[model samples]
Target: MIRYISLQNCPFDPGEELCKFRSESIGAIASFTGLVRSENEIVALSIEHHPVMTQKTLEQLCDMVITRYHLLGVSITHRYELLKLGEPIVFVAAASVHRKAAMEAIVYMMDRLKTDIPLWKKEIFADGTSRWIEQKQSDVDRSFSW
Candidate 1:
């Protein structure tokens, strides 16, 4: 279930869940969550889906991660629409027999999603100003090094 939740109240990190799921059969779990900061700061973030291509991009990313990691299982979720602060921006959970593979795959998927996925984010300010955060070219370049 490699997916970006897109619009769910996913507060609990999925990593622990994944670990528990695989505990009977595997030894390690890898997970990640992107949170919103405070100071007008957000505790979590919301995601804006690219209606035409976001889901497709996420699927492709999952496939790639699965192949690369040889993971026992995987799960990913992201919120869509006007998500408030402290909400979940994204969640990814993975389980593997080895910690190294799980950790590497987790990092790899995150970098891929941040750069390759077509999802967009609008940073809402306290003053009510909103701006689309541009994808950094350096982010893509960094993914390749992984």
Candidate 2:
């Protein structure tokens, strides 16, 4: 099994990361990419995180998902710092022998990451206003489903 998890400040190409998976035993790969939205007149987003804690939490989460889903490989990349509109913010991919497991794993990982990880986001508006986003009840509910 293979696992790659990173919290980076620089931009990454999700396609390049997807191509890195090379396992003869794998039959399906599922992925999700989160991008900064242009809605609400948002100009940019600033993500904040604790380096050590964030990395440790992500590693643990990846390990759990891999074992639970019997995955051949998984990759998760999350970015911090100021990100412009339409920029990619996160990428998650899961590889398994079956399509169901791979697809489910991606959804599970994203749901967990939304609540379990201690990442803070501030939305910057076109009007030069900014606000720290709070966790929505919907996100909390989604994580509880798994």
Candidate 3:
């Protein structure tokens, strides 16, 4: 499996990264992009992560999904620091010989990352207030249900 995992402080283009996957043996590539929203009076978001710990955790999760799905390639990029509304926060992808495998790998990795990763996010409101985003019940249930 070809896998790339990164936790960085800069913004990234999910579409560009998704276009980078190319393999004649792989039939499909599934991808997902997470973004900072403009809803709920949110102006921006601030993400905080311990670089070393976050990278290690992401790598382990990616490896698990890639191996389990026999993916030809996978790439996951998560961003920290300040992000404005509609900015891309994460880019996830999985390439495999079958569409099901590629789709499942991306979904599983994203679910686990949403519920299990240690990164923290503070949503900055338009009213000059900020609050930490808590884990969602749906995310937890989805991750544990497998």
Clashes of each: 13, 0, 0
lDDT of 1 by residue, 35-142 (tens): 665544533344566776877777777777878888776777776666656655677877778899889888888888878777777777766666677788888788
Predicted candidate 1: what Cα RMSD to the true structure?
3.2
Decide which is better by lDDT, 1 or 2.
2
Provide the lowest-lDDT 10-residue window in model 2.
1-10
- Candidate 3 residues lying further than 4 Å off, grouped into runs, are none
- Model 1 alpha-carbon drift over 4 Å, by segment: 1-23, 39-46
lDDT to native, each model: 0.69, 0.94, 0.88
**TM-score of candidate 3 on Cα atoms, chains taken together:** 0.95
Candidate 3's C-alpha lDDT? 0.88
How do the residues 1-146 of candidate 2 rate in per-residue lDDT, one tens digit apiece? 77998799988999998997899999999999999998777899999998889999999999999999999999999999999988889999999999999999999999999999989999999889999999999999999988
**Alpha-carbon error at 72 in model 2, in Å?**
0.3
TM-score of each: 0.79, 0.97, 0.95
Q: Mind sharing the TM-score for model 1? A: 0.79
Ranking by lDDT: 2, 3, 1
Maximum-lDDT candidate: 2
Best-matching candidate per TM-score: 2
